[model samples]
Target: MSEPGTPRTQRLRHEAETAAARFPALLAEAQIIAASVVHGTHGRRRPGSGETFWEYRHYRREDAASAIDWRRSARGDQLFVRETEWEAANAVHLWRDGGAGMALASPGRPLKRDRAAVCLMALASLLSRGGERIAALGETGRARAGRTGLERTLHALAEGPGSTRAIEAPELPRHARVVLASDFLDPPETTAARLSALTAAGAEGALLRIVDPAEEDFPFTGRTRFRDPGLGANLLFGRAETARDAYRGLWREHGAALGDVARKAGFTLITHRTDRPAASAVLSLYQAIAGLR
Candidate 1:
C-alpha cells in the first residue's frame, strides 16, 4: 500500500471525505424523489405478505374472526380488521457505473455518473422505506436492511468497483433483485454474459441507462475534438456533423442489442437522460422491480 500521506493515499482520503460530506444531500435528494413516488401510489407491489400495518377497515362478513383487531374493535360498536400491505422485502443489489465515460455530459447537464448516483440513492431510499434489504453488488456476501444498510450501500458505491471494468457479478440469494445504472457502452456480448450468469443464479432486476442528451442528438458541427475520456484516445473530425447519422444509427443498434440481452435475462431496461427529471427514472425502476409494468 502507498504511504498514508502519499498522493494516492491523499487522493483516496479526499474522495472518502467528499463522499461523506455529500452523503446528506445525496440521501436527502433521494428521499425527496422516493417520497414523491410513494405518495403518488399505494406502495410497492411485490410478492409475499408482510406484518407492517397497512390500514384499518370495518370488519366484513367474509373476513375471518381472528383477523379482527380486537383492541381497536372494543373502542367502537363496529368491528375493525387490521390490514397489512404486501411487503415482499426482497434483497435488492444496486450498482452504478463510475467509469470515465459516465463522467461526460453536455455543457449544461449533470455528469452521467452523478445522475446514476442520484437514481441509485433514490431507489435505495424507496426500498429502505418499504422495509426491503439492499446491497451494493460486489461489496458484501449478504444484503442489509434499514437505515444502516442504506449507509453501508452508499459508502460501498463511493469506493466500490471501477466503471470501465467489466461487472463483477456478486453471489446473491436466489430470487434477489438487482438494479444497475450505467451508460452500458460496453460490448454487448460482455454485458450479456454477465447478466446471463446472474439470471442463471435465479436473480432478476432492472437495467437503467443513464445517458446525456448530447449523446443522442450529436449536435456538434464543423470541426470537433472527440476524445475517449477513459482511454485518453483522441480523434479529430474535420466535419463532425457528417458523422451524426452514422453515430445515431450505431447508438440505436446498441440499445436494441442491450434490450435483447435484458429480455433473455428476464430483466427490464429503461433509458433516462440527464436532462430529464430523475423522478421519472426512479418511478420506472420502482415499477420494473415491483413487476408492475
Candidate 2:
C-alpha cells in the first residue's frame, strides 16, 4: 500500500511526535517571555472581550467606573481602557526549501533536509495546537489543520526531491505571518528581494537558515572529493587550510549580509546548524520573534 522511499514519511511522523511532546513546555516558556513584549501582548488579546468591552482608553471622556482600574487611577490620572475590537485568529504559512542544496546530507547523517522538514513539521504542529491555521508551501501549496494536516505536510515535504523553480512571493493576507525554512544556498540578492516583497505586501516573515556544520566551517582536510549532490558532480580539492581563512571570512560575510537584509526588510533572521538540537534553535528563534529573550 506504500510506495518505495515512503519510510521518510514515517520518520517525519516520529519526529513530529517527539517535537509535540516537548512543545507544551517550550510554548509555556515562550508565552512567559512574550508577555513582557508589547507586540506579544497585543497578539494574545482575550477572545471574549470583543462583545463585552466596547472600548479601552486612558480613563477619560466619562469612562465607566467599572472599566476603570482604581489602583492605577490612584497612581496616575491618565489611565484608560480604550475600546478595542477582538482580533480574528490568524494563519501561518510554513514554506520549506526542498531544493537539492538543502538535501545535502549532514556528514554523518542521511539527509539534513529531511531533518529540517521534521523540524518545520513540528513547529507547524505547535502553532496549529495554539489555534493558528497551518499551511505548507513548497513546489506546491497545501493548506490543512490538526494532526492529519501536519502529517500530510510532512509527507509532501519528504517526497519532494527538490524545487526546480525560483522562489516566488506568496500572496498572504495583510496580517498574516510567514515562517520560511530554508538553507538559502541560492543567490543572496534574489532571496533577499523575495523576502522583502513579502514584507512589502504587509506580511511579517522569519527566516530559518538551516545549514550543515561542514558548510559553516569547511572542515574537509587533505585531499578530499567534494560532491554536489544536487548536480551529481564531484570535484577534488586540496587541504582545507589552504583556503580556510578566506572561506570562513566569506562565510561570515554571507551571514552578515543576510542579517542586514533581514533587518532592512523588517524580518527576523535565525541561523541553525543541523548538528545541534533542533528544539534549542526553534526555541531561541521563537523567543527572538516573540521578543521574549
Candidate 3:
C-alpha cells in the first residue's frame, strides 16, 4: 500500500497544483516580454493566398469564375470573391528539460525548469502573435495557435511527462522549427545525437541552456556535500574551494562541446542563467526563430 500523501501519484498531483497556481504569472510575464520585443509585428512566413480565411473582396474582371463566392455574391449587388489570409502558419515545436536536475536552484532564484518554461511560453506567445502554430513536443494532439495554443502549451508543460533524460524525436513536418529549453547537463554525446537526429529529420530550432546562478558561480567553499539529484550519489568535499577550479573548467568545456555540436548540426544555442532577466533570452530566441524563416 502507498502512503497517503507521499505516493508518487500524490506528489505529482501536488506539483501540478503548485504549477497551476504559478501559471498565470508566468503567462502574463511571457506576454509582456513578447510584446515588448515583438511589438505588434509577427513577420509571417506563409504566402498571401493560403487556405485560411482572409476577407471578402469585390470580384475583379481578371478573377476566375470559380473564385467567386456565389453565396456572398448573391447577397450583394456586386460580385465578391473570398481571399485567404496572407499570413502563413509555420510550425514551431517546443520542449523543455524535465529532469530532476532542473529542479535544483539556489534559494532566491527560480528553478531552471521555471526559467525554461518562461522562455518557451514567451516565445510561443510571440510566435502565435505572428500566426505560427505552436506544439509542445512529446505531447499528444496537434499543434495549436493563438490563445488556445498558448493555453495548451502551458497545460502540457505544467502537467506532462517528468524526466530529465533527453527527449525522443517527435514526429514533425519538413522544415519545421523546434525550440528546446533545458539545463542540458546530460552527457555531451547524448545531446549531440538527439540534435543530429532532429536535424536529419528536417526540423531546425534553437536550444536555450538554462543555468542556475549557483551552478554557474559555484560559490560554496569549505566542506560541502554535493548530491546528484537523479542518482542519489553524494560526494563530500573537505575544501570545496579546491574543487572549484576543476569544476569551472569542466563546466566551460561542457558548454563549448554543446556549442560545437549545435554548430555542426546547424542549430543555434542560447545560454541563459536563471538569475538574469528572462526578456533578453526570450528576445534573442524570437529573433533566432524568425531568422530561420
Candidate 4:
C-alpha cells in the first residue's frame, strides 16, 4: 500500500471523499423512507428445516467440514449447515441503473434516477438493520452486515454502472439474492435476460422499475418535444395528443411483456412511479426478497 501524501494515496482519498459526498441528502432521505416503511416478520419456511434454537441451510462445497451439522445431515440425504438468524439472508446483491435516461424528470417531480437511488438505498438500510450481508454487483469487496455493509454498498453504487444498457452480472454462489433498480426502459427481452443473469446461480431475484408519471400517463397535449438523454435524440410533436392512444397501447404491451418475462424467469418485478410513495415500493420489494409478501 502507498504511504499517505503519495499520489496513489491522494487518489484513494479523493475516491472515498467523492463516494461519501455523492449522496448525503439522498442517503438521508432513503434512511427516513426505510425507517417509516411497515416491515413484517419473516416466516420460517424455505432454505432450512423448520425448527427452533438454530437455523439450518443446505451445505455448499465452500462450507468447512467443521461447519456441517452431521446429526442433521444423518436425518436426511442432504448435508445441512447450521447458522444463526444473522447469517441466513446475507447473500444479497443490490444494483441501480446509472444511465443518463434515468436523470429525466417532469417539471414538478424528482428525477427517475433519484427515486431509484432512494429506493435502492432505503432497501439497503432496511436489510442492514437485520444483519443481512449486502454487496453491490461487480464489487470485489466482501459482502458485509449492518452499517458498514450499507456504506460499502453505497460507495460501490456511487461509482456508477456507466451508460450502457447491457449489464454485467457477476458470478455469485448458490442461494444468493439480488435486487436491481432501474427504469428498465430497454426492450423487454433484453431487460429480462439481463435480470435473469443475476440469479443464474439459483439465487432469488427482484426488479424495481422506476417510472416517470408523465411516461405512464402521457399527459402532454398540443406541441411537445421529447428528448432521449442517453442517445441525444429529440422528437418534436405538433399534436402530442394524437399519439396518446398508440403510446398507451405500446406502454401497456411493454409492461405486460416485462411481467411475463419476470414470471418465466422466476423473478419478482415491482414498478414505481416517481409520483408515488417510495415507502410502499421499498416495503413491497423488501417483503418480496425477504419472503414476507
| Candidate maximizing TM-score | 3
- RMSD to native for every prediction? 11.7, 13.0, 9.7, 6.9
Which residue segments of model 4 deviate by more than 4 Å? 1-22, 38-89, 162-167
Candidate 2 Cα lDDT to native: 0.60
Ranking by TM-score: 3, 1, 4, 2
Tens digit of lDDT per residue, candidate 2, span 57-165?
3553433567576665566657754333332124456676877777686558535666566566556545555544556654334244466665555555445433534
Candidate 3, which ten residues in sequence have the lowest lDDT sum? 158-167
lDDT of each: 0.78, 0.60, 0.78, 0.75
Better of 3 and 4 by lDDT: 3
Clashes of each: 0, 12, 2, 1
> Over the stretch 169-229, how does candidate 4's per-residue lDDT look in tens digits?
5555456687878888889878767756655755677889899999999999999989889
Per-residue alpha-carbon lDDT of model 1 for 1-293, expressed as tens digits? Answer: 89989999999999889867876766677778888888754544356555777667677564568979999999979998775543223678888887779889899988788788888888887877777778787664346677788888876665456333334555655567888899989888988987877777667899999889999999999999999997899999999999999999999999999999989888899999999899999989988887732
Local error of candidate 2 at residue 200 (angstroms): 3.2
Q: What are the runs in model 3 whose C-alpha is more than 4 Å off?
A: 1-13, 40-42, 49-89, 162-166
Reference-based TM-score of each model? 0.78, 0.65, 0.80, 0.75
Error of 4 at 241 (Å): 1.0
